[model samples]
Target: MADDGLDPRRWAALALLCAANFMVILDSQIVLLALPSIERDLGFSGGGAQWVLSAYLLGFGGLMLLGGRTADLVGRRRTFLAGTTLFLVSSLLCGFAWTGGVLVGARVAQGISAALMAPSALSVVTAMFAEGTERNKALAIWSSVGGFGATAALLVGGTLTDALGWPWVFFLNVPVAMVLLALGPVLLSESRGRARAYDPVGALTVTLAVSAAVYGVVRAPETGWTSASTLGALGVAVVAGAVFVRVETRSAAPLVPLQIFRSRRLTGGNLVMLLTAVGAFGTSLAVSQYAQGVLGYSPLEFGLATAVLPVMAVVGSYAAQAMIGRVDVRPVAMTGMAFMAAGCLALGQVSENSGYVTGLLPGLFLFGLGLGSSAVAAAVAALSGATERDSGLASGLNTAAFQLGGALGVAVASTVAVSRAGAVPGFRAAFDTSAGIALAGVAIAGLLLARPRRRRVPEPVGVTMSKEESTCGT
Candidate 1:
């Protein structure tokens, strides 16, 4: 054990960080299942109810870059603690919310807090773990933990909403957040990225760009994709994005350095994250809809049935972690994409007469497995060569990709599904499209994630490489 308390107990620190990440994931998903219940209790009008979710998405998706950069500017431990405190307070506020407006406001607060908490916690993981097998394993576990949080919310949310009321969903996060806050100081050590002056222009432009893009994507399903509102929002995103790039070029201390794009691994990993999120989130939506609308599964039944997916995800994550130690990340990621494609393809078999056992089970398992594997691989690859200075940015960028991808996935899948002859057929169409996206990811993994080969120097006569030595770096 080193003198630093965190070195010897790094895994434990990972657990705490992952727990924070899990809370963020859980809060997002848990609210989904309880939306109906919340609306009824709060007497929310039909159109207004959507704001509960949209507000949170806006806050979270838009501010991720700012949050990550803030972590880099401040200290990771301080950011984590501050964010957790805000999240805790917001969760409490959500639980006590008597009106729809209050609840939505609280949710936005939670989203902002999460935007701060997530990148800091993840960057801490990269900082603590050395970039090798240990980091790979830690990332795998982190991915698995998030998977469990998402899946668990599906089950737990339904149960809580039915039995204990919708407030319990938010209330549950309070204790968990409190526990993490209490333990974190003792269990974790403080760390900061390279000190740099804040880039207000870069932050402002990127925040507006991302927030507008995500808002447009989220609204497309409700508002026509080509509607004036949607088009205007998208136009704003494009303009803002362009301005952001220009700002970064001129700024001495850009929030996200332009040089990060030069690394194929970083760029590829983010793209892969985006593509896989499209497949995974789209499939989850399809599965949920199919189970309830076509197959007539109750909320509880749907939750129970979908529970198996997370179990498979855990197994897949562990498998990926073990395999990553011995192989390149591209193959692992490609293999995961293949599994996702296969799962989506299998789900294309769903029909009105089909049952859960035959129709959804196989696809669910495969999708979960692929989700777990690819999430870990892509995350590790995204942060592959990151130092402390850019670690937070890397985390924030990956998270933003995931959020944007999920929004686009849901919007596109829903649109495609509805455009077809019937709901069931539309779902199948969406599943097929998701499979196509996953297949695209497989190709991208090959093209973008390939490591450059190193040229071998001819060894002197009688000289030999060690048993494990290779001509090229893995």
Candidate 2:
């Protein structure tokens, strides 16, 4: 470590971390294109095949907070290595599964491993870089890499499934996980929180609550929002959430410290993240359905056509990081949301006979820009105020907000799309809904983040660095 407490190998550590992050995120969606192949090969009946996807989502979304807290308690490097090993084993198991049930089981294990890796890797990144421009740039790269992973999944999944069969999708992770496991111990340092109280009660309740909520949301569209199973799952989530709150209030060492919520930027950043995911994921679903279903494009063609989104997102991430250094996070985030809304509105106008250039490219371009920019801004806002001790918890909260928001987005959009009169009309309605969500994000950013102004003087004597420069780079 340097005099500034920056890790000497921070950049290399970041690359390893981002690679792990990308692999886990890639697995999340890579299986989407392979679902049909999986179903046919494993003799899945009816909608049972969807479980291969849902099982992973439930485990990942549900266990993320626990996983992050675990990193803080057990040591980030250790947790990361353990997670990678499990992920490797799970991926191998998924590739070799002879039955649909076995594949789904392996997928759940993969999700668990992802839950461990994501926050731990992120917290490590936050720990390695000091909270300023360096961290901001690192996060920009991190956000852009995640965007690429999601987009790559669509393209890679199709190609791999077509060429090498669907199992290759799972097999792809084996090599990546092996490399991470090999390099992790060498590149990363061990770090854990001072507090040692496990708070098992709080942990259990929060996990149950989040898991149940994710389960309810993901299943709502298929099971019907009013269905007993859906209502029951949501009810369990509510009750568990209530219990978790109560437990945290009285626990000697809380799973999530309630005091952390006092940070206005942290709270607001999380809300922005949630709403951003709502717009990003929901609108992507709408666009993908429109391109492939109505436009008569094959899976590969659809992926290639929509590739512009991730490319522009990469541009936007770097641009937003640069902009944030000059101004408050508010303007950049609000502008990003505005762009997203505009993109959604444009896509909403798509017709049955619309072409890619005239209909899809423009909207995707704007949405991608917004997606990348807003993501960086939100992450910066959420993580900047965190003390080193609470870094993992903060990272977990941010990641959980995103995962939950994505689940909500996909559910709401699917519900709206299916309830409409026709395919085109349904997709249009979904896009419009996504635009509304983006607009809501704009309002949240404006209200929560500081207004733009010229650079102010440095902090007064005795003030800490973290408290003085709280609003991302502002």
Candidate 3:
């Protein structure tokens, strides 16, 4: 790589940060693909097993802004170390878990830790690298690794489940987390957002509100929406949500500036991601189950099957890197999102009796291709206009949006599946419905993402102040 005003130390630091982020995303789906085996071994019923996946999404998504805000307030490097420590400890406990409850609890712990890691990781990269190529290169690599982790999770999880048992999937994080944690203190420089002061109330209320809402969504399929449990959760969500807004409006140091919504680009990218993720993550889980249960694939077979995603996404990520300099993200993202919708739509047509070779493989390939390219493009689009100070919060918000979308997708799909009464047909109908949802994301990505008449650079602007403490511009 050319100097581009970037130091080798900066790239080295970003590599470690990307590794940590990859560890978090990879574990999320890998566990899902490995779930059936884990459930059988632990003697957990199907619904009980859902918590293992749902809990992680809930925790990670809920506290994401808090994590980012803390990074800005405390110091990005400190937050990264703290998050990594918790993630490592939680991973160990998860591996040692003897009961379903224990595993689910540990997964939530891991997610909370990940919330801390997520924002710190990206924000640090932005601080280290100057805006333009140096920054874009680092972010491209970071986002690419994220896509790679998600795709590779299923395959690696499947293999671990087959060869080493499900415990190894959790245990797998131990080495990676340790390595990243060790590298961080040595390789990373200490830095915090230039903004002074902090908002504990803003962070706390928003975290509680989002968690409550996602919890309601995740649990709704198991508890009928009309039931007291569901109704109570919804009520909690409403109150928390309202309180969160009120606090932010009044807080001296707001967790997130409500004005970010003013950017049509940011909102459009977020909505597209929300829908795309709902389909992609939901499909990843649903298909993993279908392959093992319906197709009678062993864990090893299942892992190998999902290898397609990582491979295709890596290719797509690289392609996006090349195009980022030449093309507006709008066209690239829209194209990828369209492909994703088409891929899902194709998958929806698969018959119950269809074979992997004849029916599932084709759609999987296209879906994987779309997921790989669009994810990178969409991420860049979402965070494009952000300053280095708020990059962490931006990344955190993007992550939470995706996870929340997935959680909702899982709940909706599970509800549709359950209401369909049986597993196979239920899976089919739910997946088909998800496909339609994904297509809607395609249209949004296409119609809403702003375009420039020519290859253009983002408008130069001052870095926004964090916590409303002080003014900042880059």
Score candidate 1 by lDDT. Answer: 0.83
What TM-score number comes out for model 2? 0.95
Lowest summed-lDDT stretch of 10 residues in model 1? 461-470
* Cα misplacement distance, residue 120 of candidate 1 (Å): 0.2
Which order, best to worst by TM-score?
A: 2, 1, 3
**Number of the top-ranking candidate, with TM-score as the measure:** 2
Report the C-alpha lDDT of model 3 over 380-471, residue by residue, as the tens digit: 66776566667777777777777778788777877776677667877777778777786677777776566523323444343342222122
Question: Over 4 Å off in model 3, which ranges?
Answer: 1-5, 40-46, 421-424, 452-474
lDDT of 1 by residue, 1-474 (tens): 566433887888998899898888777567766888888889898557767767777888899988888887898889989999999999999999989989999998999999999988988898888777888999999988877776677778888887899899889988889998999998877888778999999999999998899888878878889999899999999999999999998998888888666667777888988887788667777787888889998778989999988888788888888887788788999999899899999999999998888988898889889988888878877877666677888888887777677777877887888889988999999999999999998888887777645556553221112112223233
Q: Indicate whether candidate 1 or candidate 3 has the larger lDDT.
A: 1
- TM-scores of the candidates are 0.93, 0.95, 0.90
TM-score of 3: 0.90
The C-alpha local distance difference test score for the whole of candidate 3 amounts to 0.76
Kindly report which residue stretches of model 1 are placed more than 4 angstroms away from their true locations once superposed.
1-6, 454-474
lDDT of 2 at 202: 94
User: Which 10-residue window in model 3 sums to the lowest lDDT?
Assistant: 465-474
1 or 3, greater by TM-score:
1
